[model samples]
Target: MARAPKTPPIPPDARAVLGRFETRGPVRSRPMFGGHGVWCDDRFVAIVFRGVLYLKVDGETRPLFEAAGCSPFRMSADRPSRLAFYTLPAGVNAGSDDLEPWLDRALDAAST
Candidate 1:
């Protein structure tokens, strides 16, 4: 019997986007589609794709993301697949060190 090839591990740069969660709890970054699935404990909280970190959101906080000019994550579907996650704004990405609030929001949505 032949053994299957083992999948390559995710690169350090690709997974660096999830470093913030290390201190909070155990964070797992597994490859998903073209991105990585970020999980906090047992809940899916965020995703990192092409250097963009998207956080989970619910109906209540969706408007906030919109107001911040952050777009919801879209995937392939029969129509359009709008996921419950949104990208952080450019300003937030431009040297803004605080990500706790965003992480909090993601955890809240994932918890529910």
Candidate 2:
């Protein structure tokens, strides 16, 4: 049997963004490919990989990312596959200014 991978430690910056949500405290961390997934209420809300943070939003909330010029994280042999998440452009995820809106979208998605 294959052993489950271990989750990486949350980055201080990423943790700061996730801290804004009311449901943030109970987040579970787990390894996903080469990154870490943040889960709340058993649902994945975000991921941090290669020093970039990606927010998980469903179709309804997907447009917000599109508007920001963010793209789906495509996994290839040279890169980690994003699977069910979309990553914000570089520098955006780490900024508090850019972080809230995406986090809000994730929170909203989680609520529905």
Candidate 3:
């Protein structure tokens, strides 16, 4: 029998990241994959892993993320599995409304 992998604690910065989505309504975070999974109004919308933020993407939004130079989330070098979530671009402004557009897209992706 194998023991279950230990669940990683939520990163400290997860709070700040969650703060950015507050206006989206009832946003929250839970420990996952050595970071946190972000939810808005009970729907998973994004992830905060290894100190980086990633938003959910779908077929329609994938090209947009790619065009923005955002890369998909990879578990690790040893485990190269990729997820649909893409990293938040460096140009996004956390302190301003610049993140709204991206967050809106992520929320839309989560809905569908």
Q: Which candidate ranks first by lDDT, i.e. highest? A: 3
Q: Cα-based RMSD of the predictions, in order?
A: 3.8, 3.8, 2.9
Q: In candidate 3, what are the lDDT values of residues 1-112, reduced to their tens digit?
A: 9996665655555456567778778987887867778899887998877777789998898898899899788778666555679977766756655677788888899889
Cα lDDT tens digits for candidate 1, 1-112? 9985554554564356456666667988787767678898778988766656788899877787788888777764345456688987656642357556776777788888
Residue-level lDDT for 77 in candidate 1: 31
> Which runs of model 2 end up more than 4 angstroms from their true locations?
1-8, 22-25, 77-82, 89-98, 110-112
Best by TM-score: 3
Instruction: Indicate the residue-level lDDT of 111 in model 2.
Output: 66
Off by over 4 Å in 1: 1-17, 76-79, 94-98
After best superposition, candidate 3 residue 52: deviation in angstroms? 0.9
Q: Which lDDT value does model 3 have at 65?
A: 85
Q: Give model 2's TM-score versus the native structure.
A: 0.67
Please give the distance, in angstroms, between residue 90's alpha carbon in candidate 3 and its true position after superposition.
2.2
CA displacement after TM-score superposition, residue 82 of candidate 1 (Å): 4.1
Cα lDDT of model 2 by residue, 1-112, tens digit: 9987665677887777666654454767777777787787676788787656777877798887777778666545577653656776567644457666777677667666
- Residue 109 CA error for candidate 1 (Å)? 1.0
User: Number of clashes in every candidate structure?
Assistant: 0, 1, 0
